[model samples]
Target: MRVALLSDCYLPRLGGIEVQVHDLARSLRQAGHEAVVVTATQGPDEPIDDVPVERLAIPLPGGVPVNPLAPPKVRRLLLDGGFDVAHVHMGVVSPFAMDSMRVALGVGIPTVATWHCVLAHAAPLVDAAGYVERWADRGAELTAVSQVAAAPLRRMSGGAPVSVLPNGIDVARWSPGPRPEASTGSLRVVTAMRLALRKRPLDLVKVVARARELAPGADLRLEILGEGPQRRRLEAWSARHGAQEWLSLPGRVTREELHRRYLASDVYVAPAELEAFGIAALEARASGLPVVGPRRSGITEFVADGRDGLLVDDDEQFAQALARLATDADLRDRLGAYARSTPVRQDWGEVVAQTVQAYGRARA
Candidate 1:
């Protein structure tokens, strides 16, 4: 089947939902299904890609234009493009999202959607709440990344056919085989995310810094990955605090290198207060590392509390969890094993196949 995967973001930019959309599109194509992605991007579309791409323009805060939204032309293009299924990543459902839904209905094609990001933070309730409702009756099926995210998105969609299809980790590419183990006797903790206030990258740094204070000679190493709008502010803040020594800012990492870091690291910590789904945490777990995710938000749907990894509600508790995992090798090994089992049944082919089935049902 030919599928049109629509999104507000795509490759060249690094984001959880963006990664999942691109990966799913690639998997669909690999599975003998033709897939095209329509995304909002700055400047001209680049030529380095195996899949066909359509770029859209987005409005900015001031005179400067932002590439975070797809233009109306996206709907026209998708309509003209021959496709069997219209699978859209409604992470930040915008005017384009509504248009896409309308187009699918007009073209008499089955429409499916994935609830990726928490919409409440992205825009007003009118767009976040009612827009999905307008498209809910139109959608054949809607899926959320995690069950926790489903409630909010479902409520927004007026209780559409919402299912929880947790994102899976590419365990083979992210295993420790590619990267060399740390030769030294230090516990390394890595945090991967765009440095945004919602992600709270600085909070992770503070937690690690506090952990270092408690275990003065524990030899804790911190690796901070990814870049974002808050780069300058975060860098200066890191300098002010004692976190500068332990913290290594490597900017954005490629998928291959990211997996290597995951394999080489001793621990993966996600301090996101507003995480829609912790895909990075899954990758870390798949790499045989224990996770440190907060008990709140969508991550709680996975990162099993106490069994597979630590889930803390506060900084004090999170710091304690980090200290405990750092000191206990057996605990790390046991939890890592459990983490691997968490998504053992998930496969790209299986996910795409299920999606195809949903599209078929949507048509009926």
Candidate 2:
């Protein structure tokens, strides 16, 4: 199969959707299908990691991904490229991806559109626009990153089937060979997320602060990885709370570095309640760290409460759970052991197979 993977985001930028779309294209090629990335994200047409990239980007201030003049170029490509399928990846507000979807369908190419964001915050605007419902009516196959993300799409589609096409990870690559024993008695808690407001990065600091107050002598330490707009706010919060000694905000690090940190850490905390699918949490779990996160979010797909890790309903409960895990080595070990033993179902092989199935449905 010759597939064109379209997205408003791609390599040279790092985020959930960008990373997943790139990985999905690579996975397809590895499975013996020819996959090319057609992105509006500002980057060269050169192949990234041996997979071809087609950029329809228009220069804009702040390097915005939207390309107003991309429709004709996208239609021409789909018409002339002989693409077997056009797989469109969308975030909550992806105008470029949306435009690509329309162009692909207008050119009569088989198209699969996958949503990578939770729609709770954008439901009203999306509902009012009715683009998704109309797309469903026009036979554009729809999928989402997780069941949590699919719920609103299903509702808006007015009974169209919304499948769950999850994000993929390299499980073996992430698996820690042997966790290094902690030389210091201090417990390390780690989290990786773009320091954005929606991700609730500051909430992690508050949770840790409250946990320290709850377990005054537990020697708990936190390391938040990843850089974003919330860095200054987090720094000021840490300073005001006198948490510099216990809290460390080391900006984004390489994946290998993250795996090393996970191996050295005791637990991973995901503070976002609206997380569609916690990829960072999954990576930590793959590296043999127990995950602590909300029960209602997509983290529940893999992090089973009381089995894989502990789940909390509110900030107070999150703090209490962190304190309990910090104080109880046995519980931490148990959860981490389970996390290591149980392989995630979102491995690239499984995800590639699912992608093939979605393509089949789109073609049908």
Candidate 3:
């Protein structure tokens, strides 16, 4: 099958959806399908993992970094791409993605629209937008990364079937490996996520600080990986809390380095409350790291409370969980073993197979 993966963001941009688009395209191609990525992110023509990418020139409105492109260009691309099916990854506020979906359906192509965001507070607005887009075309199939993300859309779709298709990670690439022991005599707590407002990176600093206070004589070190608009604020917060020596914000690192960090770390902390499908937490668990995150979010889909890992309610509980994991190596090791053994999701090949089934349904 020839597939066109459309998105508002792509490579060189560090985001969860961007990574998912790239990985999905690659997986599709590996499954003997011709896959191409269409994006409004302006960049030089590049091939990610042998998948061809077409980057269209689009203007950023109101000085915002989002790619809001002209609909005509998207229509022309859909018409000219010669793809058998179109898979559009929709963001919470993605004008480009919606435009692509409309154009793909306008061209009478089988289209699969996958929602990748959890619009917690703005869900009503998103549902309103969905209602507005209801006139476009109803033939296209709909999916979401999690039930939390699918709720508002399903409500707005007026009973249109919205399938839940969670994101997949390259478990083999991120598999467990021998990690060098930490030189610093401290419990290593690691989290790799875009330092955004929804992620609550600043709150992570407070959690780490409170954990240090609760665990007397226990050295708790936090290593935050990934970069975003909140980097400066998080840095300032780390300094303000007098955790500069213990907390290190190394920004984004290479994929290999990330896997190594996960293997070496004692605990993985996910502070994001609105994660549609905590891929980072899954990767950490695959790397044999015990996860500590909120129970209400999508991380609950994988991280089992009091079994594979510990799930908390608020920042206070999060801090206490961290402190307990930091002080007890036996508990950490046992939880880590359980985390590695827990069956979360299928591999990329199986995910691609499921996606192909969705495409077949869209075409039928």
What's the TM-score of each model vs. the native?
0.85, 0.96, 0.91
lDDT of 1 by residue, 205-253 (tens): 7788888777675778889888887678778878887567788889988
In model 3, where is the ten-residue run with the lowest total lDDT?
60-69
Clash pairs of candidate 1?
A: none
Root-mean-square deviation of each candidate, in angstroms? 3.5, 1.5, 2.7
Best by TM-score: 2
Instruction: Assess each prediction's global lDDT (C-alpha) against the native.
Output: 0.71, 0.89, 0.82
Off by over 4 Å in 2: 182-186
The weakest ten consecutive residues by lDDT in model 2 span 177-186
Candidate 1 lDDT for residue 275: 77
Off by over 4 Å in 3: 59-69, 130-137, 179-186, 342-346
Query: Residue by residue across 1-364, what tens digits does model 2's lDDT show?
Result: 9999999999888898888888888989999999999988897778998999999999988778998899999999889998999999988889889899888888888899998888887898998899888888888899998888898988899899999988989998898668767533357999999999989999889999899889887889999999999999999998997899999988989999999989888889999999989999999988888899998888877888888889999999999998888788778778878887888888999999999999999999
Which should have the higher lDDT, number 1 or number 3?
3
